[model samples]
Target chain A: MNSMGLALAILGASISALLAGIGSAKGVGLVGEAAAGVVSVDPDKFSKVLVLQLLPGTQGLYGLLTAILMLSRIGVIGGNAVELSTAQGLMFLGASLPIAIVGLFSGIAQGRSAAAGVGITARKPEHNGKAIIMAAMVETYAILALLVSILLIYNIAI
Target chain B: MGTQYASAVAVVRTMENSLFTQSDLERLINARDRKESETLINSKNAGTLPEVWEMLRTFAPDSKELEIILYRNDFHNLKAVLKAMVSGREPDSYIIQPSNIKNDTLKEAFRTKDMDVLPDYIRETATQAYELITTTLDGQLMDSLIDTACMKAMQESAEKSGNDFMRKYVNLITVCADIKTAYRCSKMNKNRDFLEISICGSPELDKESIIRATLGGTENLLSFLGNTIYAELSGLLKENPAEFEKRCDDMLIELAETSRLQAFGIEPLISYYIAKEAEIKNIRIISVCRECGADKVTITERLRKLYV
Candidate 1:
């Protein structure tokens, strides 16, 4: 039972990182393709397109932060070892779910928007700032999810 | 869906800067001599007609894209060869040499008397057109045969593309050409026999109604068009046929440019190509008008709207 409790807690940390990381990877790949397309024509605009390409990558970092925070909160890192019951482990998993589910979907959606921003930059570099803002708007949901997961994990009894 | 043309679209975005503006076209129209026109074109790093055409050929994304845009030339060359061959003239100067159908291959097909060398879309008409003039010596009959074949090929290709814009373009061109054909046949007093072979069929326009209207006369034709999407065309046809053509061409440009705002798609790439083609066509028109020493007013009236 103790082993199962530890396993579920580890699974929760993994989900937060893995799902969000996968989403960000998918998003960043899509944006990179768009950036490559723009750079193929105008090599000078690489710097501009690079920013758009990196925008969708934020969700991955957010997910990683949530995973790290949750890992540390449950004394699974360089802290005093604690034998968590199955219900407590399940609670930890539930808390991580906010970031895990949201980050995954939000990352891919943000990447698509960022790719569109790259197109705008390719055509009219002057509007790149506005394009960036538009793409950044999609990251709001991911940020909200991160905040909720952090609050829940922090309040969960050790 | 649009990713296939990402690189090409990117390239097309850069190419937009090269399209001639209104003032540039006005200068070309007002140029005094061929040397002056050549100077203006060279200033922009685009030489004369053939040079600009070569640039487009070099930049086209794929052979299918090339085929769609240049098939008219291919059909024109085949028609020219059919006409020239019967008259004992060399067909070299008449051929446009499409990427898909090589001019040399066509020349060889003629020399060897084997039309199989030609693409399927053209082989039937090329053979029929050649035999058409050879047997009857009727130039009009040969002309209609090739014209019908060209329209059919365009229709089939547009249908195959499954693109809405392409289908609309096909509809506009066939309908416009049919209107012109109907007008010409009216004066010639030709009956429905010529109409049956001449008019290109489109799902957008009822061929039977148009044929009936054409047989009835201009009033009947105008009445029929009034009820269709081309309602405004009836008035334009009565007032000025040239303006009517310009309006239809403008509609096509608008349809193409609508895709320009799209972030991802082959639509923008294809639209840019169409716009460039229209620009080149206008240049050719103005260049020819200047060479012919046409009056500025007449030349201005004939010039189609520049596609920017």
Candidate 2:
């Protein structure tokens, strides 16, 4: 039984969740602060700014999904634990890197875009869709990273 | 770039929508009577300058950079207090609102002769101006000294904050003040001593050159200004001081417009204050013109540029 391999796989899963969660937390918090400011001035704009605030939150979900899939693929869930070689554990770690790194950065980047979008919505509520589209454009990279992470997790030889 | 004051900037953007537009000013100018104009202005729900200042302070309390915006008012209050002390008149009537220093604090500092009670930016100037006014009893001289000190303080603080927007703001203010002072001094035939003390030189308009040109008379001063980047203003200064004043204010609005593109930072917050100030100024002009029964063309010419 390679405990070190299981430990490595667990470490990879933890890293994916930890880094991406931090990014989303930071991104969401930034937008929340800006949205609260607008709402404080004009309460009617709450719904518009709320949408902007939620834009940066997707990366955290991607990270959680990646971690769950990795844990399940390695049989760490369902009350079953599979013995993995050191190379296999390392491969699992490698698979998590795309989402871990990309999710972390894209979350913050998307948050800034969304926060700026919050300003647009605050000023011109009629153009709220433009702001949403601009912020959503940053999500494409995070989606690509999540796809790659899932593919690697599923295809890795046990 | 890193975004500072993200929340404050957004709030300012929201507030920007409430500011007066050009057409609003036109309607204000054409209002049938003072009552109508007042009603139109009140309906806009544009907050007072003090209210705007309080809101900004709530958002960016720690920003020393934003404090520079009120230095002019602070210095004006200082002048008022000193003049009141000299004339034995109450300063309350003349003291301006939205000042960085409280009126009571300024009065108390002067009453007790404890300059320490004043903010560090104005402490030395207050002390020096107090001493100069009491001894010489020269109100104009005291005013020049305080005005020069105000410009210098604004420049130093803006440079220390390393904010380009503030630096340019201070520069524009200094240039306009120096040019106005030189024009006035040249007209009065003030000596070199007065010119040297009154003109706070800017990078664009050198103090020594201004003094020399003024000594040569208003013609030389106007000629010197004509060659500078502010050449367009030279014609306005020559024909009408009122137009020159309007041009100076319009230039400030033009500068504030540049900050409108900025999404994040204290620049937007500062520009909002500028916009609000212009809106108030426009309201004041319309009220006064309506009271004086000034024609639309005259009132329209005097109205400063709108931010929106």
Candidate 3:
């Protein structure tokens, strides 16, 4: 119960959620500020800008999902209770780092790209698809990071 | 590319679809009558000249960029007031009352002869121009004083604003004005002293060399112009002075075209404002020509490039 491994695992999971969530929040907020400008002049564009506003939000969900998976793996969410060694805990923390770091940076980069994409739609609403595509391109690195985090966590011995 | 301008740029881009196109200008050019042309123009924007000016005012956020644009109008009003002071009566013409310096302030300054009421930038030029006109009754001398001041104000404001696009704009404006002055002075057979008083330029242009070349006459001036970026202008100046004048407007429109593709920064807003101004100028030219039964060639010659 007093295992340092459990503490490290929890800390790692918490960071995975915290950093990614913060990054997505900032990214979404940036797009929202830009969207507000267009919407002020043309309120008809609310739906289009709203779509763009949500693009950066995916990172937060990815973070939450990774955190949940890690929590479950660590027996914190109704699983076989096994106290972990410090090395095991540190390994879990290391496994969580991919998503925590990459998700944070990629989410922000995605948000900026999406904000710029929102500008395209604001100017040419018919080209919203292209704008969406442009923003979505930034999601690749984030998805790769998510996969690495999941793969590493899944393969780590308990 | 500042984050603050993101939204402003977006709104401007959305508004770009509403701009008059080159084909739209052609339609105006080929319109059978003035009424048809006016109908075509009103259909697009649905506003008079004043409303168009209003859009130009709001399109730019209230920043140093907007101030730079508005300064042209401010100095033009200064010219109007200074000219009226000598005329002993205000002309019933539309004077551009800028945001910083209002029409009332301009009129009051003219009436009171009070430098205190005027903005510090223009106070000296206004005083100098007023004294020159009153003492010698030289309208041209007064105009040169004001013109030099206007150019100086433009150069300072553009430089101080620290916008690269604006700095380029200032250079284009300064070089064009210098060329026009040199051309006019050469045509008049004026000397170095007159060129010193009349020609104002930016660091981008070598005004002294230009003045010296201009001292040698139109051929030397043309040879000097041939060596600069304005080499194309020399041929136009030789072929037709009117067409040469159009190059300045075209230069602005060309630069604005680059802004049309831009999705970020204050440039889109700046370009849109200039584009709208060009649109208005073209429309006015077409309308007046159609009303007067002037030829299409005359109207087309004066028409500026379209933003769209």
Candidate 4:
């Protein structure tokens, strides 16, 4: 029964990570396309746009951290298997949901910002640093959501 | 009075509309022929200068002044400089815009070796700013104080206006001022007066903090974060002033993009103003670069992307 509970919690984390990361992957891919368009115009602007594109990739990192934390809860890291009650399983699901959903939307939003940044860079190359910083601002909330999920998963007990 | 103010806005709107477009800016930046570039600039200047003059007439019909208050401020400083040269005095030009203190009056007073002909108000203002320059132990002290006071005034105005454009412009100006001050302080390696004369509205980032944050440009100093996200964002570029400015330009672009996305009524007007200003500056840059015979690569790097 303990192993079964452990299996469900780990499964929850994996599913959340998959959903969150897919959003991030799509986001970064969109920004990358925008960046490629900008670079085609002026090769020198490559490094600047690259930073803006990298902002969306942070969501993936957050999701991966959530997965790792969830696995640790199941004692996949340092201890024997710990089983979570059904309540704990629901808690894990609730906590991860915010990150997954917010991460998806924010990631897409970041891509839009990156596209704008790319447009600016095509004209004002120096503005790249500022562009990346602005996109990063939107990403902050998503990261905060990721942190919430990690803390929630950590507090859960079998 | 309401009609007058409305007309002023209308004139400004019309002038804003007539400003050089993005395509004009690109043409200016890319122009290889000197005569052609000058023709473009002169024609643009000719077209806008009259509109601006007309607007000023509409604003203060009787006065009909040709002066740009800000640009004249630069002229006022230049007058201070010329007077100082004639009188064997070192005066601070930063506190008062050069054109404000009556250029002809200052020159006349200086020419006669008498400061009395200058208006009492102008003389008093110049004297206070001058004292800061003359009494200070060195050039460094004077520069910091004047820069601080200007930055402080700008910050206060920005805070007071609270309108999005005014606030953002003020913040942008303050951040740039911070970068300039920090750059000066780090290079001179001055320690005692850094905080004393630093701009009040900045987020405090110390010398080690700035060096760590910017990675290369400045050394020991403090940075004060203002009441905006741009303030903290500025810290990341505290090390490289130029890079920080570029970042600011990008932030403006982001703001413009967001405004476009939201389809806010006022946003387009503001964005067009910014973009047009960038266009004008880019043309000016091209003119200077061409005159100075700077290479294409160098000129391109310095050109604001929006304009060129």
lDDT of 2 by residue, A1-158 (tens): 88888888988898899888888998999999899889889999999999989988999999999999999988888869899999989999998999999999999999999999988898889999999999999999999999999999999888
Could you estimate the TM-score for every candidate? Answer: 0.85, 0.98, 0.89, 0.46
DockQ of candidate 4 against the true complex: 0.01
Q: Judged by DockQ cut-offs, is candidate 2 incorrect, acceptable, medium or high?
A: high
lDDT of 4 by residue, B55-142 (tens): 3444454321112223325334634565465457766543362233444555555457566775432443344545655565355554
True contacts kept of each: 0.34, 0.78, 0.54, 0.00
Query: Which candidate gets the maximum DockQ versus the true structure?
Result: 2
State the lDDT of candidate 4 residue by residue for A1-158, as single tens digits: 64555566767777668877887887787667656645543566678778877888877778778887777777777877666777776777676776778777787777667656655555556666787777778888887888788778877655
Instruction: For each candidate in the order shown, give its overall lDDT on alpha carbons.
Output: 0.77, 0.91, 0.80, 0.57
Off by over 4 Å in 2: none
Best by lDDT: 2
Check candidate 3 and list the clashing pairs.
none
Q: What TM value does the first chain of each candidate achieve?
A: 0.96, 0.98, 0.95, 0.89
TM-score of 1: 0.85
User: 1 or 3: which has the higher lDDT?
Assistant: 3
Candidate 3 error regions (>4 Å): A1-5, A41-44, A75-86, B46-62, B91-94, B97-99, B109-120
User: Residue by residue across B97-168, what tens digits does model 3's lDDT show?
Assistant: 434677888888767878778877677887887788789888887777688788888788888888888888
Q: Is candidate 1 or candidate 4 better by DockQ?
A: 1
Tens digits of per-residue lDDT, candidate 3, A5-86, equal: 9999989899999998988998898888778878877899999989888998998888999999999998899966568889
Worst 10 residues of 1 chain B by lDDT: B46-55
